[model samples]
Target: MSKQVMLAASAVAVLMSCTVNAATEIQWWHAMGGSLGDKVNEIAEGYNATQDQFVVKPVFKGSYPETMTGAIAAFRAKQQPHIVQVYEVGTATMMSADKAIYPVHQLMNDSKEKFDPTAFLPSVTGYYTANSGEMLSMPFNSSTPVLYYNKSMFEKAGLSDADAPKTWNDLELVATKLLASGAQCGFTTGYQSWVQLENFAARHNVAFASNDNGFGGLDTELLVNNKAFVDHISKLEQWSKTGAFKYGGRASDAASLFYSGECAMYMNSSASYAGIKENMPNTEFGVSELPYWPSVIEQPQNSIIGGASLWVLQGHPKQDYEGVAEFFSYLSSAKVQADWHQFTGYLPITQDAFELTESQNFYQENPGTRIAIEQMTAVTPTKNSKGLRLGNFVQIRDVVDEELEQVWSGKQSAQQALDAVTARSNELLKNFERVNSKS
Candidate 1:
């Protein structure tokens, strides 16, 4: 052979040798950002360090809505990742995309891992499970809405930190007093419609929709116009106009207010702990349960899960699916989960991690960290209290937002806003039902 031909042959041999034990890469698309995003990368790195047969790569695609849109587009284009992290509201949309997923239950069983859905808090697992008790998506960064307060603000406003509100009446008193005491702002919240409607319904043990908030069937309709809901919204409207409550736009806008000491209290996801820890390192904060209405049927039940889950996408090669499954297995480990829970404020889905945290006294030392776990496991879930899984829920939430804005802006009564939301959300549900029907 000539010199050039020999060199080409040598290069080919080098390339072949380099491919000797290379593992298949499993892509995981997620919607986590900031500190939680970094924690995700850390977990992925730990998993990759554990094995040579699988490499898990996490890609950030923006907020929850944008990520879902991208995933649907990618699915249609036949370029879906091996794994995608979808928010809780996307459950119905994902469940209906039957051909696009490899269910997590099957993956765990096939991988022969000691996967036990029963070990998870039912309030968390039930959100993503099929009727047959198989969970479609693995609960990853599950969070519940919690009442966060500024400790110094409380003391400055002449409130005892030991005596925060336990019910709606108590909150009204506290908020009224905080306002009267001339705090910059008494209370503020993010995701007005979500915390006030969806989670608020769950915390108050009411149905935001028929068919147990759409977990039962596709024919579900929004019933957020219930008396309890209207009352809650009306009260919030009064508080807003009275300067007792400041309305931040949508989706976690109030977190900044609390972190910046502009608002005395904030209602946002528990997952904000990592960011709060960084931004307000010296800021003293308290975590408490979302207060419930005193006239409600009962005390607060478990609040619904927030954050997102790691879902296995279909149409990938077996090797890639196996790699994805193995990566999930690593995530599900008790030690990894406990560490993640410690690093991030997300509830550990597995009982082992919860117990480990208890044994380590993480909660005892952290003070308010146990509130979420306690709230999640406090009651046996009734139909209304379990969680929501409505189809086209993201669009339905948009409907809730628009009508709610009308209520907040005094363009409509609370009842009128909710009635409009119910009508519009049902239309989306009907569309979902039609599309998912098998003819």
Candidate 2:
């Protein structure tokens, strides 16, 4: 070959290498596993395909608590990811560690990204915002507890498939019939503490903790031993004896029971919709708002969010942060949010996404798809329903689960179990406040 031709090819190869090296890489560590992890990777791939200047990489870092703890350790070692996904319970911990986080509002402003906080749904952003209304993190995959029932099972039970139980009384009657009709279990639930206690009290407009469920201050104490809470648990204990209500462990175990047709009715996060469809394609199901108690005078209040959000970490390069900002902007688009909501059974985080879905008649085509959105937006969120901001909440939930199991085992009454839970959880609350207040 001629020397001139060789020189031209060498220059072209060097330019290609520079172009590939110039693209910034932004790492995002999250706790999503299995199919949800695939969705996270798909989102990142879409963003990478859309832009040449930045590439977002997603890494699963175990469960939610472990992921948050890992990020903390990484931060101390000066090896943190550009962003980390923290669950709702970790909101207080993240808010307190202001030094380790670069708040979302400031990140967007500093990077000159187009971020309009008002575009997001009020209930979603409220949980991760400052007292001054500044957004702390980007809201993603926000979900609320809802009722899911097998329509075919309902038909066999001689119940109306189109009608869902609006109150606990109705649920009891239906559960009795469902079990008597050869179903293995009448009803079961995931997230026992979340569905039975936290959201239950919120829907009744009752406080789960002092200081507006810990949003007002860090010195909040749990109020799960109150009459309303105890009475609810006591009723569940009674139902357990009659085979009407079944405790299927914590977190998505009941989902398996329901999807396998072992249980006729199930209560779980709205996000479970995707899994139910993917895992049980043959089973027809209906989704509805969570049941309330008809006797309660102030019933039907809003339910709290249950999923996680994206938090920006400190010490990343300006270029990496700009990539993070750009990726966030892409994720926040209405089209992306709508597709995500439809595909994952999670509530859309923005008003535009919700409206876009509505405009496309997606809900009409897919029956029961709108129930979660309707349930969440049924009423403006009260102080009790805004969402819990408790510290060390993952451990507190474990304590609650243990005490609740005692009630089911008949070792203790509902009131007795709840009393123990409140006492134990308060100790954790006190310790958290003591340490965090000083920090």
Candidate 3:
């Protein structure tokens, strides 16, 4: 070969190698598992395919609490991922990690990404926004609790699918009918603290904590031990005694009870739709708005969200952040967000995404898919109905679960259990406040 031809070939090889080495890998740690984990992988793959500058690597880091704990430890060791998915309850904790996080709003601004905070749903973004009106994290997989019922079980119980419970009183009646019809368990729930307590309070337009559910300041305290909460818990305890209501353990563990046809009705995150559908493909189920208490309010208030958000962590290079911003922009596109919302039952964080899904007739094709959106946007959110932003909320949820379990097991009365929960959770809040107050 001629020397000039050889030199051209060698230069071509060098350029190819430089291009391959220039692709930055962005580590993304998350808690989504099962079918949801697969979706996360697909999203990362789609973005990587669109560009060669940055490759996103998604790693499942166990459950929400576990993922958050892992990220905190990693940050302390200066080995944190570029992005970590944190549950809503951990928002306060993430916010307090001032040196460890790069606020989404700030990151977008610094990276010069065209972002409009107003593009997101107010009800969804309210949970992750700062007092200064900046978005702290990218809202992903936002979901409100909804009622899921076994259609066949309802028919066997002589209940019409159209008559799905609308109020707490109605729920009790339905549970009784299901139990009387020889159903193994009439109703069950997952994320007891989230669906039952936090959302319960929000739906009733009652306070979950003082200082506007911890959104106003860090000096907030729990107020879930009110008369309404006590009454609701007491009713559930009574149902537990009659076998009308079964305690399904914690998290989404009880989802098995509903999908397996053991329970006639289940109350869990709207995002559980994907898992429920995948697990029970042969069974027909119906989704409805979460029941509310008529005695507490003339009409039910809006429900709050319960899924995790994508938080950008600090310690990444400037170029890495540019890639992160671009990836985020792609993730927020109407097509991408709409596809995700339809597939996973998560709320389309952006209004355009929701509109895109609607325009596609996805909700009409899939019955009950829009129940969560309707529930969340039923009414203008009041301070009480917006969402919680308490410190140490994750640990507080554990306290709530523990105390509520006492009530479920007949070890403590509803009032006593709630009182204990309030006291213990307040201590956690105080500690979080002491540590993060100056930040």
Among the numbered candidates, top lDDT falls to 3
Ranking by lDDT: 3, 2, 1
lDDT (CA) per prediction: 0.83, 0.88, 0.91
Q: After superposition, how far is residue 281 of candidate 3 from its true place, in Å?
A: 3.3
Model 2 clash count equals 0
TM of each candidate vs. truth = 0.92, 0.93, 0.92
lDDT score for residue 12 of model 1: 91
- As for lDDT, the candidate ahead, 1 or 2, is 2
The residue ranges of model 3 lying beyond 4 angstroms of the native Cα positions read 1-21
Candidate 1 lDDT tens digits, 131-216? 66789999988888888888877887788877687887888788777777777777787777668888888887888888878877
Worst lDDT run of 10 residues, candidate 2, spans: 13-22
Clashing pairs in 3: none
Residues 1-439 of candidate 3 have per-residue lDDT tens digits of: 6999999999897578558777888999999898889999999999988988888989999998899999989998999999999989899889888888999999999999999999988889888988678999999889999999998888988989777999888888898888888898989999999899999989989999999999898999999889989999999999999988999998999998998888999999998887888899998999999998878888888899988999999997889999999999999999899989988889999989999999999999999999999999878888888889889888898898899998988899999999999999899999999999787
Q: The CA-based lDDT of model 3 is what?
A: 0.91
Q: What lDDT score goes with residue 356 in model 3?
A: 94
Off by over 4 Å in 1: 1-18
User: TM-score order of candidates, best first?
Assistant: 2, 3, 1
